[model samples]
Target: MALSTNCWKYLVLTFNALFAMSAVVMFGVSGFLLYRLFVYRHFIGVNVEYPAILLLMMAIITCSVAWIGWRTAKSMHHFHIVLTGVLIFLVVAVQFSCFVWAMVVWDSVDIDIKNSMTSFFDVANEVNNPNSPESIRWDRLHVQKGSVPFSCCGQGPLDAKFKPYTADCSTLYQRGCAKPLHQYTRQQLLMVAMAALISSVLQK
Candidate 1:
């Protein structure tokens, strides 16, 4: 079926509106992630941050693209239309790149988190100076972050003790946080994947 000029214009406007909304959504999500990492950057490495920053940039570009799309819909100017098309392509490209980058970071960070947690536990156990740089950070992670109540001292019940530094000492949890944290990371990756699919398919 052939569409009239009015139908095409309406379609473009509708898509532009949706695109703008997606930009806002991406901005919120990426901004939140960036804020979280900024707070706990000491605990988690900055590797995952690259994708998040890229997503933030993508959101900004997407907003520009959507604005251009909206104006192009009204004026139907050749140059504006061409610019909007190019910007749309750029948005999708950046989104897909970020998705791949996120997955790669996820794979590496999961393992690194466990080892890092173990080291933090070790640090908390060995280091007597509570005010030391490492101790301060781990203390916040342990007691403040509820790391102790959340899980056991080590990987297992008989593994070792994570005491002295921590205030809690009555009982310990046998389950380590690695599996649970891994699941959470998987969930985040799933969200990224879904967003990438929506952005690529619908936007394209």
Candidate 2:
């Protein structure tokens, strides 16, 4: 038992620096994304901003709690040791909550995207006056990524394109963007959430 405790002590000491470094990087990146999302919110939708905010919060809390844990671990006081354990428990709770939140977000992403696209087109299509600012912006958006225009016909695989059969629906990725994209996105994020949950549990 003594040997195991000593091993953990040294490991924490070794990793505390790395933890601090990683926290700083996460904080910076998430903060930047949260800030920039405002400008591009209209283009991609506001779905991204919320996650960035969540990420920033997690980074700050994790880093702060980790430092307290490290400090309390090094202390000889019984109270400090108890505080350390409590802090670790709090981290585990937060991680679990984050995992749950991520899954919920995963389920809603497709619906959110569909609504955003629908709302955008309703206002963007200045078909009667192609020279209008909205029409110009809509055309510019389409040209930005030819693959995006060609990939999905409408919101989902079952959905038909708003217009008649075109090269976009006939030739390129024969499906709606929503289902496949949602599957891909959820798969990626699930892995991340699982990793984070496992890491936090292990840390505890």
Candidate 3:
């Protein structure tokens, strides 16, 4: 029975180490995405990067909590084991709450993107060249390796060429950047939540 318990403890530790590493990786990814969004924030309009920031914060918190879990998992001290369980429980609760909240607000994410894109299109139409910052940013997103804009069929019947500041709804990709970005963020949060759940189970 003692040997079996030791084996189970080590198994949990292995899982904890994996979770800790994943949290670290998530932290880096969220930070990078936040940076990218910040760079193009002027054209994207208000509150565009807020979700990314939230994710980054979550990642940071997970990393810290995961580290504690890992350390406790490796330690045989009775107090450490009890403390680890409590900490894992708290983290799991907090993470789940945040995840659900984020999902609830996620429905409006597309609307915000639409609003931002509308503003972007209005400004882009007014400019003839990529001379303006907003226009340049708009062009930058669609710019390919050969400096050509990749045209996509939008809602309009006619497809518009994505060139400099001339890209309108017709010229932009049917799947807007915002949709994919928001989806990816949502998925990331889900992944984090799953990881947290697994960690909680392992703690038990």
Candidate 4:
């Protein structure tokens, strides 16, 4: 049986509200990711921020469209509803592009991350001379970040011993930073998929 127009409108409104909440979450997470990237660019690699910026842009757009969807749901104006649909279509396209880009990045992120870590590892290994650049940077990171070395990432992994002229996997974290990065990206993709699925369901 066909749902009454009012019922359909209410249902769409609910979906829009949920999607707006998702946008809020995405905005907050993306903003935090951007800050982390800025602070740890040396170790994380500067290029990683490109996708984050795009995600932020998409979050902003989604917020605006969700607001429009809310208004359309209430007014149920034919033209406005059509406009909202178009907006959703655009968002879906953007989400697809993001998902694809994320997948591509995911494929090679480990290699890229390991390459970036190599330099930092060298610095950690050479952290004996107080005046040396590597020592200074290494000390600054440990003192400033206060994260578990080899066990933590973001800004760079800290070695457990922190002894000068020494490096070993025994003290370094076994799990690579790529795992968390991949997890976060996968979450973002899942959110996009959920939004698209919700929109499709609402249309029916």
Candidate 5:
């Protein structure tokens, strides 16, 4: 059956809107990540990961979709509509999943940091109290640094006592309080891989 001109125009317009939105979202997210990696070098680190690569891939896919949509606008076709629809759905799903995973990891890190902080404070208060039992002090000496530092009690010039104050600080806090942040970043990298997988599946 021959497609009506009005029907074809509507299809092309819809495709254009969908692809354009996808392209903008992908580009914006990828660019933001890249900018963060560059500007906040310590936060994102120098090493590349699967998530970073996947974000880049998503940006490329979105651009491709935009291009195809533009072409379709010039010459609408049934096949183009089907292709665009499938691509839009797949890309959107992947993007949404990646975003959700990122948020989850981000929140996990926050909770971990908060818990670590609470533990550090409890140990610290025990250590600071003069009337506290010698046993409590002994126990506090064994506290290792946690993933995030509640206070710089065991860092810098004070770190000299970290070995003796092990109970007051977690190994994570002692070694470098940024370890959990690094883990959070690594999880973000995994999200990029997820996005890449989606892009690959969509390409198929």
Candidate 6:
């Protein structure tokens, strides 16, 4: 299907806008995380090296891709079919990788939460013995951990009975709970996949 010039223009505009928005989101998230790392040295701990760098790199790459797409939109025939195929493949690969990364991070965070909870439970049980002052400290620590909810979902442990956490976590946990984070991550990945698929179809 040969898209009209006007339609192509609109597609380019839309694509550029989406990429710009994504860039902003990436920077914002990464900036906040970096700030947290600065303020609370151990907030996310030593494992924090990848996410910030990845977000910044993604923003840069998205901007570059958007620029290329915008510039090429007006001269679609200038590129050979093989080149177009390569671009399409890259787009799909990038989006898929992003989806996988999000899933992995989400899963990691979930595991951390679970481990923390388990430790809290153990400490709570030990502290409840009534004979140790350490028990009081353990109870306090348990309360603190329970009070702290997963940052991604913004739902505290107290709210774990709610919809997204209850339903989404179940599916995510069943999916090996290793790299995949949450159902939301899956949804985001699907959106990226759909965008790439649609763009490829339209280009054809």
Among these predictions, the greatest lDDT belongs to 1
TM-score of 3: 0.53
Provide the lDDT at 155 for model 1.
Answer: 43
| Candidate 6: tens digits of C-alpha lDDT, residues 1-204 | 455767866776676667556656655655554454333222223333344445446556665666666666656555643354466457556545554554465446544534544565467566666445445443343344332122222334545575443334443323232122223233433444343334333333
Provide the clashing-pair count of each candidate structure. 0, 1, 0, 2, 17, 4
1-204, model 4: which lDDT tens digit per residue?
246987899898998988788778777876776675656555556555566667678788988999999999998899998998898878767766665665566556556656666777677676656566665554455444442333233343355565344445454545444456444444544454444344334332
* TM-score of candidate 5 versus the correct structure, residues matched by position: 0.44
Error of 1 at 17 (Å): 1.4
Report the C-alpha lDDT of model 5 over 59-132, residue by residue, as the tens digit.
77777776786777667677886787677677666666655555554545445444544555466576776455
TM per candidate: 0.69, 0.58, 0.53, 0.56, 0.44, 0.41
Q: Where is model 5 poorest over a 10-residue stretch in terms of lDDT?
A: 140-149
The sequence of per-residue lDDT tens digits that candidate 1 reaches over residues 1-204 is 336877988998998999999899888887876665555555555565667777788888899889889999998788888889988997898798877877787778776666666776677668767567776766555554445633333343333565335523455544444565555555565566556656666677
Q: Clashes in model 3: which pairs? A: none
Q: Sort by TM-score, best first: what order?
A: 1, 2, 4, 3, 5, 6
> lDDT at 97 for candidate 5?
61
The digit string of per-residue lDDT tens for model 2 on 78-193 reads 78767766765776677667666667766676676567656766786635466766655555555443335422344443346554433445555453344543454455446545
For candidate 4, the lDDT comes to 0.64
Residue-level lDDT for 195 in candidate 1:
64
lDDT of 3 at 118: 78
Better of 1 and 6 by lDDT: 1
**After best superposition, candidate 2 residue 107: deviation in angstroms?**
2.1
Backbone collision tally, model 5: 17
How close to the true structure is residue 176 of candidate 4, measured as C-alpha lDDT?
41
Please report how far candidate 4 places residue 132 from its true position, in Å: 9.0
Segments of candidate 6 deviating more than 4 angstroms: 1-3, 41-44, 78-92, 95-99, 102-204
Which 10 consecutive residues of model 3 have the lowest summed lDDT? 144-153
